[model samples]
Target: MSLIRKATILRPILYLLVVCSCYGDGGGRILVFPEDGSHWINMKVILQELHARGHDLTVLRSVESWYVPQNSPLYTSVTVNPAPSSEEEDLGPDFFSDLMQRSLALRKMFPLRRFLEQQKDTMAMLLTFHGGALRVISAILDDAVLVNQLRDSRFDLMLTDPAFSAGVLLAQYLHLPMVYNVRWINAGEAHMTIAPTPPSYVPMYNSQLSDRMDILQRTENFLRYVTIYVQERLVIVPIYADLLRRHFPPGADLVSMQRSADMWLMRVDFVLEFPRPTMPNVVYVGGFQCRPAGPLPDELEAFMQSSGEHGVVVMSLGTLVSALPKEVTEAVAKAFALLPQKVVWRFLGERPAFLGNNTLLMDWLPQNDLLGHPKTRAFVAHGGTNGLYEAVYHGVPVLGLPLIFDQFDNVLRLQVRGASRVLEAGTLTTENFLEAIEDVLSNPSYRDSMQKLSRLHRDTPLAPLDSATFWIEYVIRHGGASHLRTNAYDLPWYSYYSLDVVVLLLTPCVALLWVFIFVCSRLCCSRLRRKAKQD
Candidate 1:
């Protein structure tokens, strides 16, 4: 063969070898600290994706964790002892059920009084929750053996849910590059922490206001924003104050440590969230957990098919609150009975007396599969983020009965987009529930709107899960993503807001104005004196 032909063959061989070598690259070892409950569900999806991509993972969970198990093929689980009398460790369906009942009662009070009482209740909850989270952090830090083992593990990065600050504290202690699987931080939404959220338009978490606001609405949002700030500073921050003082440098604070994460895998897509300022390091992996529907069990498939052309409605209240108040459940059951469509509900408590033959109750149902099925028309939901996004993924309209926490805001987003309707679970009645369901089922606009959102959500170049995994690996490859992180986190509040620069700039102008006034006054005095002397 000629020399040119030989060289061409060698080039192709070398390229093939290079491709094979890159494909076989060994994965990084990752340390994960996850929050329990629905948050763990989100984290586990990402972990599964990472595992498939050849990454090794180690997960930390509390001994009394409700969702996280001791064994999983995905990662090695390290269970830690929670603090004695830990409120979070003791949290169960019954606790949230009581809270729902209290919320319902509060809703019946006078508006102003109800607002005050709700704030008081929310503050108490925050204190208890954060206090429990702090105890877990203290437990981990207090253990010399665990701390040494963690340090010796030589992990590439810490991937954590910042809903509790335990992961943030541990990542900082280990001096690891941190990536947050976050929607909420210690105090409020993660965006409020990392982005420039102007209260003029950006609604506070739980505010339930849209991006467009009238004057009074804006005022309410502003107050809510201020309340969150106060809660964070006075309530949540102080929970970690003593720990920071003992383990961290002077002036170290929880918010700053949280903001220092190399990447924020925000679990909100713009399709579902109101437009707001965001940081570069904040990657939106919303609906990352959703996937194409799998084959349903034969019995479930038969039920779905039996609905005929009328279709089916799927309902789930999420992981935390297994069942709503008894009265509310009865109202919902009666409403479901009135629907021509078959209803599949995930109900954990006693069967409602008013339930109809059209409705089927299961302790649990295949939520994603049901939503994706062609027979599935609308979803009755508690407005949990996971379920809402899944509905969006499958283009199913939602009739939301938001009970607590961010559920209200989650449903409101879909309502604003014309994909869902919201009803106050506290005031839910058979008549109103039936009316809303009828409206959702009869209206073609709701399904059309949700389908549009699904298109936009699905049109991304890389899948949300892949995007999340890629950035995580990016941080691992580069050791950290400090270049992508903004320096604003290190700035003091005044500096971050540019208040110091404003004062500095205003000082010279103020001095000039005073000088000009003084000179005029002196001139006037001289003129007056001359006039008097001349007279």
Candidate 2:
């Protein structure tokens, strides 16, 4: 070949080589601290994106993920599998459900006064269970072989959810910078970490109150805040601290270390959640799990198409809620039978006997895809954050059956915004459940409101996944990018909010007023004495 021809062939090859090299060449090793399979789903999408971007990703996950399906790519792809011991297996996949069930029972059986008193017992039990879980998780993460692998891995950062203290323990053990990916929309937890909005406008998690609260609601929110604060700091954090101390070295200060995470990837946004001020290190990645609906499976497509013009309703209580109580299941079945809309209920155990001809019961579902379908009109859900966001992303109105944790609050806010109706588990009846579905379906306003909110959620400058990946990479590139952390983390609560300044300003004014009044009284007494002498 001539020299010019050879150069032309070499140029094409060079271009191809450069393109391939640049595709995902961020070249950072990131460790994802494994969690329960269900909550891990929240991190899966973003982590996959990070992985595709050429970051070396490894997950330390449970060997037996009961909640994670065998076929799930995310679970199957896990690099390090921590096998569950007999005791750990006994804890069961429904451990979270069992906790939520207790909270639900507390909400139902007692009045506010009685509930507050009893909450201590519930909290104590939760602390015990959480402590046990942490020990097991720590054992897995701190396995001699695993520890050696981690130590030799040269990982840049550890990304995890701090719901369990194990992630923090692993990070501390390996001495990697920690970043948090929170799944729950717990406002109190956020306040402790980054933002410190007043309870007057910022409702407590699971309070079921709006941001703009009445005096009664505000008082309740404040009380709830106090309860959560005390429970987390005095009970939960102490338990976690103790657990860490057993395996790790002293002087770890686990709570402080948790608070000082380089970044927090919160599964919340102002569109669904009420507006609140946030610190620079806190990033909202709500609707990050949302994506364009792909082609549905044949059976699911047929089920949805059966509804025709009336459209379909999607009912799911998330992965945590494997099955409802028999009575509630029957109630839902009866309610769905009466609706013109076809119902696709995600029921894992035995199918309810009363399940209507119009309804389809499946053990698993492609929930986001179903919600995005044009035929999907309304969602009857347990008000879990992911399901709620998917509904919002698709502009589908909802009939909320809020069970526990932040579900009550999530549904209440949707109700406040006129996008849904909540049938509290305590007050739920078949008639009420049916009526709620009808109300959401018949009402045009609910759909309209949801559509408006959907627009806002989808109108982000960057897709939620991309935004999350960018921030994750940013942290790696700048070595934690700790400059983004606000000084509020370092300041005491009173100093951070300047309550002392308000107290100082008020103190001098009150002192001056007291002195002025005393002088006037003395002058009056002297004038009276002079008048008497003259007389």
Candidate 3:
């Protein structure tokens, strides 16, 4: 072999050796307790990256999980049979669609009435969901053999999605250092639990109000903020009471356990989320799952080319929601028909009678690939965090049909930024939907705003995924990130708020004021007596 050829052949081998030496013989052992469905999608991305980096990952999944599979090439799967009834299984496929329909119905009522009813319904749903989750964890804990095996495994850390408290509780029980892949905790947005969220500016989840709030809006925000705590205390905390009492220390509670995480990999960016106070332990890795688009399939590419001058519009309501209500879908179909742009929709339900020939309906489409297509004009979405971030990443303007949960708030953020238009599914009509579509298509500003946002989101020191991986590896290298965490979680509520300190500081001043008042009154009485004597 020639000298140049031998050197070239040796180059890659030397590089591989260098990389392997940097990571050591074998990577850190990581245990992942993930939430099911869409949350799993996000977790899976991180797991894949971690696996690629030479980490040994073990994923704990429920037998009835819809998304977290029992078999995977990335990680060793540990499937736990919680009970005869599983939370994931109990929430049948139609759960989200049904919830969306109920939410739409509530939207038609008086605003106050709607808020009250919605709160009631939401609380009931949360209780049921969390209750089922507790059961699953309880089952796992009860399995002494399984618990012992997990303990003996000597896992470096527990990485979890704290959407449900199961992983939090389990991590605490196993005494593992935890890193949370979290956006929402059990009560509400993760920030509400760990940061100082002043109601004056930081809007509450589901308020659908922006950071800039007037007095009335601030009042609403404050009330909603109080309501979240109330729900957490009364509704959510009790669901985990038994598990905590049995498995944890006397003072340990769900919120405190959640806050005790070593690091929070917040799946949000300030470009997409309203700016708020954050903790040292919290790291924003928003759009970690997003990447530059790859080539589309031959058939899909042909469709894109066929759009010609008009371009194509892509729509997807996320994974959980396969379709909207019949009336809403029909109206949407009619609107898509009116648009000159070709439509590609990710629809799973029966075909809408009004669906035009211009529209292509598929059970699934490569969402990221389609959004990145050169001929892609605009996106119609349900305002999921993943999808919204993907849209921002791709710089595609949106027409939002927000359904439930954080969808309303997610779309509102984009609308506030002038990157998207929002519509209510309850009041959707063919004319309004088409008008909204036309407005987005015709207006140059929406695309401009979104493209600007894309530039900002992309203009980061490191890719969000790489940042997340580094932090995860950082946690592993150090055993835990305790130094980054705050001692605030250790303080009692009164001490945390400084209520006791306020009382102590005020007590001396209050006593001094009383003494002064008494002396002044006595002097005045003496003067009055002397005046009477003189008279």
Q: Higher-lDDT candidate among 1 and 3?
A: 3
Please give the lDDT score for candidate 2.
0.76
Candidate 2 Cα deviation (angstroms), residue 27? 2.7
Candidate 2's TM-score reads 0.83
The C-alpha RMSD of each candidate to the native structure, in angstroms, is 4.7, 6.9, 4.5
Q: Count the clashes in each prediction.
A: 0, 0, 0
How much does candidate 3 score in TM-score?
0.93
Residues 1-535, candidate 3: write the lDDT tens digits: 9999999899878866864565674689999999987899899999999999989999999887899988899999999987776454368887888898898898799978987997898797888778778878998999999999999999999999998889898888988899999999875899988898899999888889999999999998898899888999999998888777887789886777888888899999999899999999899999999988899989889989999999999999998887898999999999899888999999988899988989999898989888888899999999999999999999999999999889999999999999999999999999999999999999999999999999999998678997797788788878898898888868888999999999999999999999999999999999999999999
lDDT tens digits by residue: candidate 2, 236-303: 66666655676667776766666777888888878878887788888888888889888799988987
What is each predicted model's overall lDDT from 0 to 1?
A: 0.89, 0.76, 0.90
Q: Largest lDDT belongs to which candidate?
A: 3
Best of the two (1, 2) by lDDT: 1
lDDT measured at residue 243 in model 3 versus the true structure, 0 to 100: 77
- Give candidate 2's error at residue 401 in angstroms: 0.6
